[model samples]
Target chain A: MDIQFEPLQKRRLDQAKWAYTTRRINRDQNFQLLGGTLIPKAGDLVLARVDELGQHQRLELVTSRRASLYEEDEIVVVYGNRYAPDQFEGIVPDHLEPCRLVAAGGVAARLLNRHDRVKTATRITPLGLLADDKGYRINLSSARLPKAEQIDHKPLVLVVAGTSMNSGKTTACANLVKGFVRQGIKVAAAKFTGTGAGADYRALVDAGADPVFDFVDAGYVSTYRVHRDVLLDIVMTLGAEMSSNKPDVIVIEVADGLLQRETARLFAIPEFTDWIDGVVFAANDALGAQAGVSWLSARQLPVFAITGVLTASPLAQREAHDICGLPVYHTNALAQKSVSSYVYSCLKFRSQKQSISNPVREEVG
Target chain B: MTDTPQPGKIHCRTIEGMSQTNYFVYIPSETTDQRRIFYTVHGISRNAEEHIHGFIAQAERYGAIIVAPLFLKENFPHYQQLGSSATLERADMAFDHVLQDVHEWLKIPPSPMHMFGFSGGGQFLHRYAMFNPKRVARMVLAAPGWYTFPDPGQKYPYGIKSTLEWPNLKFSMEKFLQIPTLVLTGDEDDQRDKDLNKTRKIDCFQGLNRIERAERWTAAARALGRAYNIPTDFKMESIPNASHAYESYLAHPPFAQQIFDFLFEAQN
Candidate 1:
């Protein structure tokens, strides 16, 4: 039987770019559109179909251009269940089902867990894998990783990480890029991980970097349930791609909170440790700053300075400084060229670029 | 997309005379009263499967059929050689024969095709449309690395005249000028890539990069229209912040809604 389908409108998933090329939509005897809570994972892309949309709730549907949003009925693409903490969470079971919209930015996964403040998830159905001309599934993991020589010549890297979403990660990172540019240093900025979004990358570019890039450039829309190795590949790809310009410094932002699934796993890798020269940690307040600093300290990771939402409050800044015993710079202070000087001071004084062998072993051991 | 799936099939169509077996078409489940068609060309990647997606939405909405033909380097090598006389297979004739095969395959009469191409496709369309203006309704020459300028002093591809003195790349000015065209490229697409042709002759005639090339063709074409008595329908646009990629083009601005408006002026 010949089946005709329209792609989900405003598909936020960059993978949706291949929706039209997907030739196969076959299913098994057990293939019933199940109303489910299983979030999509790697294996889920194999051969899923659109599950029935029975429940009524808000659903976030992003378009192919990353321009706007749409309703649940508007999107038509194959997606898997997600099990990430910060976004949606659930198992991508053997059966097909209707998963909730765990992320508004651009991911559809089942919700198994969420923080209390987070709202109800939007619902969606998975269409299935978009196969290539040869009739093979388009594997996100199979995408190319940039060669080591592509990213080899970076001057130095200053990573800005946050304690939680909306903890002023973008604010801090953009200002950091501005500060470095004001100091007359050529800066290339990047956001290696995250579900794909245009604003953050655009914001970073607008802040004065010659150009900016994110995970979307490498293919996967959102990094939510993306494989760990793919995340490493993204880091390498962005590193090599951004290094093409030969900037004097490269400032990268690791999306979501420090403890978020992908970022946490990425930080655990030794290549990540050896990749960056300094860290500028961001947090909401003193407690978050202390927690973030403690987390870094426990891993023997070097912290350059603490900045973020807590910097907006004088008392929170003072408390964070006292508690973490680290230099605290407000978002405004970071915007000033003085922040560039401070980072330079840290890189100059410390034995930067520490060579770590088997960062996974060091973390586990 | 929970509603009933549209009654259309997006399938591949084989053209026996074509360079590759990879051309595809999206015919809506049903046809409207009037038949309209689009012939889209792919970039250097030669992936018609990927380029076809850009038009599937418009195809369904306008009841228009999109035929995306993949022109391989093996059959059509070099951005300029395909249309110039220095080729084993003349791209202009390839397109003509391919469409004849398509019309036969679809069992439909010939219709004025709306031609569109991106990057290398843009190069093919501009020169092809210039020679086959009667076959084309309107054209979009987008971000071609360089163009075939209206000049006899310079070389072919870069300019119409060549030292080889092969078949003339010339056409009637009034006929070509009347063909509605939009010559466009990204504003930030000025980088010198390895593939960018930088021979001293090309650099001397056309300016520097893609950005300069777009400006050169727009100005030259419009000027040619003015020199003759014909009214030029040619216009130029630059998508800000985009550089040699469609994703960045979408990000810099919402060029989609604008594109739909341009392509469907005849439909609407």
Candidate 2:
């Protein structure tokens, strides 16, 4: 079938809201449009029309801004599963049919489940898949930043994780970035796992982190349900890219809590644990902090400090301090040069010890 | 020594942001479009002007810019070895602040710095290079009172250990050893004095005198480089007719010439 290739019809692509996940896609190569009988894979570009608006009334655009959605508005989004306990649980549909905009970051998935508080996800009809000149469908994988075989110089990497969603991981990460920046240290940041979104990316940028990155740049719209090996590859690939930038240090935030499937999978992997210099646990309360610290310690992972929303309350801070020997610093404190200096020193010490334990083989004369 | 004509003008100015400390800049009279930057650090005496006078001829000869920063005793008492104590502002940060001012004042592009340090300044330069190896292009250490050995088992100011006072302390031996280094000392500079750090641990781990300390530190650095499979360009030279004092070496013109030759060897 000769799909319409008219200039006026192509204007539809121009008018559509390009989601953040598809930001790396090159539109110039999208010469053909194919639809029907084609099964959509995760990360495949999907052109769809808004059937109705509900939980998501706006779409995050490529420019790191949001655009309001209207009925009959066309959107170019990536198909991927989303895992947000506080919001919606979704999965990419096998067939090209009507699906919901599970995330404002431009993800289309069949709604598997959602919390009782939210209205139904906004509805969208899958119009077709964006295709290359030879009729091959475009994928985020093809547009990902160049993969790195191995990193020669790995910068100091600090991972910020939490007990659960809304535990202030991004805020903690951003404040840490600010602290490193204030100390005149060159810092780069990345979100190792998350649904494709610009809010977290923008937060790091505003906090003065140069060359911030995310899993989207690694070709995934969302990390939920991604295979353990694939997730490891994403972290390594993104890590090499971050190291290539040669920042003095790197702050990486892993979405959700330690118990979260993908996050747990990564923490269990020796490659991920060895690659990171340290882990700062963010928690909702004293008990959560205790549990997270113990879980990480059980794996012999280096837990430097406790942070997150719990730090807002002095009582909770003291409680966490009493329960866990580690110092509990508020995000505000984490932004201070003194605190960052101390944290950097601790991470450096830990990285040194880790390197010694896993000594690199020396060549004999 | 013949009276050599000075070929550079010295500019004494306060660092823009850090007004508490001042620095000296020596710009060659005959400027070149591709002029390189050379930073010379002074010992406890803080004789920054003498440093300018000492290196002015070499700066002109190589058409390189010279920066000498004065670390006041009251402000940076522990300027050497960057900040030995927790309360003091790190001398490395002050050094960086001066470089920042130079970048703005001279309108020069970003580039790694070639460094020369004497006694206390030598202590500062080597530690600074270890913490931020990528920032240094080349280095020359002249008769430091002591040295920070490449042993990670010991603490900072003694070995390659991290501390809370210094914010940017990511020391990588593999990277630090890549920088070409020159260690210089006087043949008669073996006398132990008040200026020299005299501790049982220092005496045992390093050496009793500056000359021995230079030899031990140079050897340790080379050993570390070899351990990491990195070829280190480290050289140690002794002044035949000189002692511990900067003036004593400055009087020997060839001493100053050796440092400049090492710093600009790559260019040649």
Please tell me the TM-score of chain B in candidate 1 relative to the true structure's chain B: 0.87
* DockQ per candidate: 0.00, 0.01
Tens-digit lDDT track of model 2 for A1-365: 33443122667788889998898988765456677677789999988999999899999998779999999999999999999988899999988889999998999999999989998999999888887777778889988987765666677889999999889899999999998999899999999997998889999999999989999898888899989877877777888888778898999999999999999998977667777778888999999999998999899887868899998896787578657756677877788765677677667766676678777612100
User: TM-scores of all models?
Assistant: 0.45, 0.58
Question: What's the lDDT for residue B197 in model 1?
Answer: 76
Please provide, for model 1 over A65-182, each residue's C-alpha lDDT reduced to its tens digit, 9 standing for 90 to 100.
3323334234333343344444446544443455654443334455677766556565555554334434444444344334342355645777888897778778888888888889
Identify the runs in model 2 with alpha carbons over 4 angstroms from their true place: A1-8, A361-365, B1-268
Model 1 chain A scores worst on lDDT over the 10 consecutive residues at: A20-29
Model 1, span B3-101: residue lDDT tens: 222347666655556464346676766773235677778788776777567666666777777778776677667533464354555766666666776
